[model samples]
Target: MTDKERLLQYCLRQGDTHIIFGYRLGEWCSKAHILEEDIALTNIALDHMGLGNAWLERAASVDSEKRSPDDLAYRRNEREYYNLLLAEQPNGNYANTIARQFLFDVYSVLYYSELLNSADDTLAGIAGKGLKEVRYHYKHSAQWVVRLGDGTVESHKKIQEAIDDMWRFTEELFEMDETDDIIAKSGVGVDVSGLKEAWKTQVSEVLEKATLSLPDHNLSRTGSKTGVHTEHLGHILAEMQYLPRAYPDAQW
Candidate 1:
């Protein structure tokens, strides 16, 4: 594929991950255990949506077909999406949601940090703006992880379970494919594989502080980069795309 195509795909994947995870976090609207957390999660969800839209704009700018970001986000089939498997996983419980967010935020911080200096100006700009938000997101989720993991007996158990279940999917965040190879070679994409150790270190330190043990596993999940995703993505899309699909020509 051409560099434009690779860049477009890269932007869309990051955008999709932000949008999907934002939607999952939004599900906690008015549902968080405490009032402060309820508002905090909502605000964070908005940050994700805003970041996603920024990346979508980047994608649309470079797309050969000149597809609008809205069109790409709402009009594509599940198989056409490129969000990470970890982003698409169901938010089982509060702990599950926090665990997923924590892991993703850690990766996001590193990913954006590297992207801040990308040869592609658009990507670099987006990263520069997004890095600040992701840092805050990481802090929020990491604190929650520690709170739940090191809190009461029940809280500790549930958060530990979340850590185990979500850890397997973390591997995919660092997976590289031909698209990544081509884009990175051209200085527009990140070689995510190189970010794995740093991510592990950040996660390990947080888990230790939380009094949680990282699971030892040899297996990891993949395929979101290639448009394959878990069933949860379909459900998320169904809900997220419902209004646009049902009223294609309608506008607020």
Candidate 2:
């Protein structure tokens, strides 16, 4: 692939992760345990959508076919998407949702912070705008993790289970490939592998404060960036793309 192709794919991967993750958060719109939490999750979801759109638009800017962000988001099948495996997993419960958000939030802060100095001006500008929100997102999710993990017996058990289950997927957040290599060489992308240890340290500190154990597993799930994914992504796409696919020419 050409350099622009690599950059396009890199942007698409980022766009996919945030859009899918944001949609997952949107699922909790009216289902949250309380009203205040409901608004908080909704606002976070909106932030994800905004950030995802920016990345997708970045990809569009580099596309040979001149695709729009909406086209990239809604016209693609599951195999065309590059979101992390963790983003597509079901939000089983409040704790599950929070656990997923906490893990992603931590990674976002680290990843975006690195992007702040990206050689690509559009990407650096996007990072500068989004990093503020991501830091707040990290704080919000981390606090909840501490609260639920250290709360009553039942709450603690649920949050701990959520943490353990989600830990394996965390590995993919730092996976690096040639697209990363090519882009990073050109100073436009991050070698996320370098971010793994810091991710773990930040995660480990939060888990400790929450009285939760950091999962130690030999196995890790991966490959979504290269179009591989679990079954859940199909379901997410079915719902997210249904309207746009069904009404291809409809205008807002």
**RMSD, one per candidate, in order:** 1.0, 0.8
Badly placed stretches (over 4 Å) of model 2 are none
Native-vs-model 1 lDDT? 0.91
lDDT at residue 248 of model 2 (Cα atoms): 92
Clashes of each: 0, 0
Q: What lDDT is reached at residue 182 by model 2?
A: 85
lDDT of 1 by residue, 1-252 (tens): 777788889889999999988898898898888999999899999999999999999999988887898998999999999998888888788999999999999999999999887998888988999999999999999999999999999999999999899988888988888888888887877889999999989999999999999887766778898899988999999999999999999787
- lDDT: worst 10-residue window of model 1: 214-223
lDDT, residue 5, model 1: 84
Clashing pairs in 2: none
By TM-score, the best candidate is 2
Model 1: colliding residue pairs? none
